[model samples]
Target: MTTPGARAEAGTTRFTVRSPRAEAVWLCLFAGEAETRHAMERSGSDWTITLPGDLSGTLYGYRAAGPWAPEEGCWFDPAKLLVDPYAVELDRRFVQSPLLATFGEDTGGIVPRAVVPAPLAPLPPEQPRFARGGLVYELNVRGFTMLHPDVPEALRGTVAALAHPAVLAHLSRLNVTAVELMPIVAWVDERHLPPLGLVNSWGYNPVAMMALDPGLCPGGVAELRRTVEALHAAGIGVVLDLVFNHSGESDVHGGILSLRGLDDAMYARAPEPDGRLINDTGCGNTLDFANPAVRRLAIDTMRHFVTHCGVDGFRFDLAPILARGPGFDPAAPIFAEIGADPLLADRVLIAEPWDIGPGGYQLGAFPPNWLEWNDRFRDDVRRFWKGDGSIGVLATRLAGSTDIFGPQRVGEGCRSINFIAAHDGFTLADMVAYAERHNWANGENNRDGHGENFSWNNGVEGPSNDAAIIAARRRDLKALLGTLFASAGTIMLTAGDEFGRTQQGNNNAYCQDNAIGWVDWNARDLALEEHVIALSAARAGNLRTFAQFPDPVVWQSRDGKAMTVEDWERPGADWLRCSAPGTGFGFTIDRAERSVNIDS
Candidate 1:
């Protein structure tokens, strides 16, 4: 099962690849434009070759001989050398060339080559600390500290910036258990971005899933290890947001990147009649994880991160795709394997819970030990605070949405992750000030981004000069923060949301990696930051209020009387109160819950 790519032995190195469709496979070595090809022996689904003498630091690739029929999904081009699917390191950036899509041409100098590094050391002993009912602060690698003054000028926008004393101190102050970093894996710009003169800073469109982006991790895995070590020393954990649903390679017309060039069968292609790609993700190609080889690739990639880079967990983007056979299933092989894997059993797993594909909104259907982003909680809380409904639904969300998460309450804390804003949508500030999306700068003539953002403009659409409107907006922001903290589930806060960071109402700033995306640290609203700090500390002090069981909630009406079923169904009844024991705090709409004294 471990046989994949170059692995150094006592005095020799072995190269293995799984190409079920290829008739023959060759191990090609490159040295100063001179090439040497060695034919590989076939063993079922694996093709392998072993070479003697210490063969570390060698640059190599592979070529498979087979059919070249794209219409039926067998794309085997012996001339267009392929990258090892398990390549740990790439020598340079993958330069896009039109010749890569065609067959039978010696692409000697242009294709990316895999590097065999010296033997790696074992990872640190696993001691994951992320679990239920803790805070997770999500931040972007480059944009997080790009403008921080304390970070070194050279390392301002790299992974190294995260370990800087200033950044670590700030994280420590927030009391979050983990930092959920956005995609750090190697990715490429979309084909359309070049004509519009834009860059892909989000790194979601990944080509090499295992390789870390050079711009972020220049020293490769060593840099990542150092950052992880630093965070562990500071009592913080790292959670990587991974995107394995699709690759940077688009459809047939798009460029042939890593996986597609190696084998077209790796993707989830449509059934007969059309034979087109199953674009479940908004991205062009969805990986066929039902294939054993692709499943192995994904498992091996996660193992490498855990055994080499010391990552604590993974937050899968568009997670439903990984469980697709004919349709999404909770018992998908990948899920079963991860649940049973020794290395991953204790690691925290989170899911974005939906995609553009059919039957993709499988929110509470994930297996146990996995957490999900609660969009229902987000929307309900937003609508309630924005004056669309009563506080009844919001009360349910603050109690961990037992009706949605499950009445059983199998886990100790909560399975839902509560948040008012995230990366794809508007910031906390923009959410309160924008009635509609302002994505005119995304080059789509303002037609892009979500239509219903659940946002309110307070009175004016954009920036306001009225004192009453400003005060109300600030109050609403604090109320939202309090509700998030007072909730029973894990709370999430974007990097710069505490001090009112805004993208000028650009709900979708995925492509605008300029001032529109980076956190403006210089314009910190100190008052708002301090207020959030107090809210966080208060939340921590009152954790006992949310007991482990789902039955901790005891609902009451505005008059402090127990509510009946008729009261709950009453359309006119708005104000509600929910109380729990030990934490001495109460969840109420118009009034604050009295903190009970233990002395009594």
Candidate 2:
């Protein structure tokens, strides 16, 4: 089947745009810097125009004339130009302006030229190589190599640098099976960031879902393919963390860059009782799956990566928003389609299965084959080790979280993606060094981040030179990672967490595109780093013990008696053992001393 966007067809080129709410659609072609506009003929929901010249190098944008009712979700204007949502490459980078949402605002000067790329050589099909009981490293492309002294200066911070032997050798030692990259898709900084001298360091706010961001891909998608090939050679797969719930275009008052300017129904808008765009993604707008075009874009973008880029899997950022129907329906077509899709059926699909909207906390509600990020495991593990809870909750998480993804559990290939820290929150060093979010540097008056972090500071709010505090911090850090490594199912470690990177206590470092967010290898704790490597190796060696029906975890009080029902949640005992004898593993949680001892 022919792909959706503009493509060379026969002797002529065909341009297509999807505008279900338009009265007319125009295809504007730019040749030799001079523009020509032609009315596109309609065929059902798609509008197409065929011309007699090779439009491969020619620049083009679409404009749709439709009803101008912002109240009822129709904001189509012929004066403003729109980018083809399926455009593979662009001549230049994209910039956002609030005037893009204004009616009759001609954006001829700033329209991003959609480049007609040369036909790509057929990519070799990738067989799924990722599975349970391996480490998944979350890395930021630019920040990862930006400060690295080993990576060549010319290739530093570029996608090609990931293929360098220096970086691969480092990852190989960590026993990483897959590198889950933060959003590398073309994204724009948040509207309010420019005035504060900040940029979207993390690529969560995306504009073009298909076009790889130039900041990450200086050598284009080919560099990404080369990096994937390199990782495959090293036995590591690539999993992209994608945000399909919202675009960089913020709220009603935000920029109308691509998706918002193309079609209003493409986004979900509530009708009455404070009529406005739904904020399911907490990013001001939630993409509407009620529109088939939105669903097509989500599915097709994933296929585009698999078909052209050779990605092994995808971790859907704020995934529940992509499955919304009245609310976040478990049986939404997006889930059903991917589950039944020939291309995606066997692929490794992960979900950040929640959003900021109604019924959004759907941790274990995803389909049978889809694995989910286990935040409960994260919180419970931290709380237990922090001496704030009992062995009950921690035992459940370590045993593959049967209560959440239960009834069938890991045997059905649905294992929790366990993690201690990720790109969003405090780093491993900051987690024990700071008790609260120190986001004053974010220019939001330290009021912009999460309130409850579930962290303990070992009697110090920030860094300390005291022998007792430092020793306690290191011990607690080892216990936390030891818990994640001992847990069943897949494991993920944030890029710098293994080495104890800190953000000066800043929990929401999303806006800081500087040293605070970059993974600084220079300030690493060598002992901690080696400790993490050991945990990863041990995790890799226990894959079979991790997948089972009757979970291997058994909870026992210090007296060696099996824990009673009352002991599971409310603990009167100060210490207990969490063990799986089949795996020759167990941990003694000593609440009195606030220490953990692993008994093999």
Candidate 3:
């Protein structure tokens, strides 16, 4: 295993090889025929290489010479120019080309290689300060800024665009404390994308955890750093939505781009009893956190982000998979290691809290100091506001879902990261405008996405010119936002949801990289934006009320009756007025001390 300090230099790149049975090995750089054969000496099981010249635009890969055997788990295909697991820059995106051969094929025992450019110099780190209660704006890089006409054309679709004055000004005006960027790491197009002429988006299929997606930062790390700095200057934190549960590599037949070539043992391969790679992640092989070496690799990847890229925090996708050790255990060593790391202890750590494996839905199981993506809160709120389910579930979720998140956590209020809609599912507009998921665009013939959406079209499906339906949808949207803000928890709003962004009814847009997912800043809905801004201000400006312990706020029905635990369980409760002292907004109720002093 490589030490943390080994590759901490500006331009140094490292690779590890495990050929205990081999005599010698060399690290080769493959840019083109002219510079294809430059070799570096190996020290022990590791090979270290520093480019001879400027490696920014240069393309390179590796060739390891070792014993050739298939059954012994040693398929040394020196002919294949393997990608460095720690590669920072990739020349071309991985496409399912015939160039990728099977492991058994020993035709010259080599495979075509993809060139990886040298790492850019690390950026100066920026540490952000997050107050206890603040609104988080979750956005996708390409989707958020790409269609904004106010931004410069060159800057669009890139990280630099996010720092553009227009973007920053909008975020500042929105009063958001942090911008939760959806997966900016290098990812791969799903196998179905090429045929449908679409691309894997939402960036959930990550190929590298530490490296930024070159597609999002053409100018490279320097550009990304500038963006982070700009956000920090605006008092806005940047948190990356990370997918560490699995790689772009699918199951056994998946691409051998990086990890598979470097070390398959680090990944959770199929158990030999059945010899099928664990498909816990539902995307591909689940990472084997059971291996101490793999755990170190994950930690190293996160450290690179903090020490090099200057990110504020990470929201782990399908985080329950990280704790699975043959079975789910919240006290897993990986969590313990991260919680104890001095550098990472203060950083924001969030978990998606579930995977496809058995017992994967461990919502409140995370240790203290970590926030969890509260899907129950999202679903119950949606259902209640849509008038589909019991308001009791909504009440519990609003009160911080104490049933899920135990009462012993350390956060001021709810450690729940509450949101009605996120990247993986429908946008806010579609949730109230479509009763069922419309995922035909994903090439799965509408078979993809969640079945129990708990959505309502309010008398019409898809687009409706009816004024009443439109008004109802808008009200429902506001109500959902209101519930999210009024509830006790950390609030996260999807980027375009503030202005009612829509995917034309497509709930699962993981494959639509086109305009379907992009936010149309040109067609701004002023009224909707104002509502969102007001709610954000209320949350940020009224921290005390939201932070109150035991009973933060009291809710009462319009009929002057205090809503009980039973009323919350009853369906069809359209609206409830909640009152709390020290809240920025003033309210009047029948009870004594009718006025609650607060600050806005």
**Ranking of all candidate structures by their TM-score, best first:** 2, 1, 3
Give candidate 3 regions above 4 Å deviation.
4-25, 31-35, 38-45, 48-58, 65-75, 103-127, 408-411, 547-552, 559-561, 564-575, 582-600
Per-prediction CA RMSD (Å): 3.1, 2.4, 4.3
TM agreement with the true structure for every prediction: 0.93, 0.94, 0.89
Q: Which has the greatest TM-score?
A: 2
- Model 1 per-residue lDDT tens digits across residues 1-600: 647888988899999887777899899998967879999998877889889977887889888888777888777777876777788777766655566666676666776678776689878667796756667899988888888888988998788889999999888777767899998877777777767877777888888788777777777788888998898888889998988888887777666556675667889988897899989987888999898777888888888889998999999999998999759988899998987788888888999999889999999888867888999888988887776755567767777787877764453667788898999899998888889999988888888788898898888887888998887677777777767777778889999998888899999888877899999999876777887777666665654344243455577887778988777767646567666555356656542321211111
CA lDDT, every model vs. true structure: 0.79, 0.80, 0.70
Consecutive 10-residue window with the lowest summed lDDT within model 3: 589-598
lDDT of 3 at 264: 59
Off by over 4 Å in 1: 31-38, 78-81, 95-99, 102-111, 408-411, 542-550, 564-574, 591-600
lDDT of 3 by residue, 214-256 (tens): 7787666667678888998899988988788888866655655
**Which residue pairs clash within candidate 1?**
545-583
- Best by the lDDT measure: 2
Q: Write the per-residue lDDT of candidate 2 for residues 298-343, one digit (tens) a residue.
A: 8888888887788999999998888886587888888778877878
Ordered by lDDT, highest first, the candidates read 2, 1, 3
* TM-score-better candidate, 1 vs 3: 1
Clashing residue pairs in candidate 3 (N, C-alpha, C atoms within 3 angstroms): 79-110, 79-111, 80-110, 80-111, 270-276, 270-277, 391-568, 392-568, 392-569
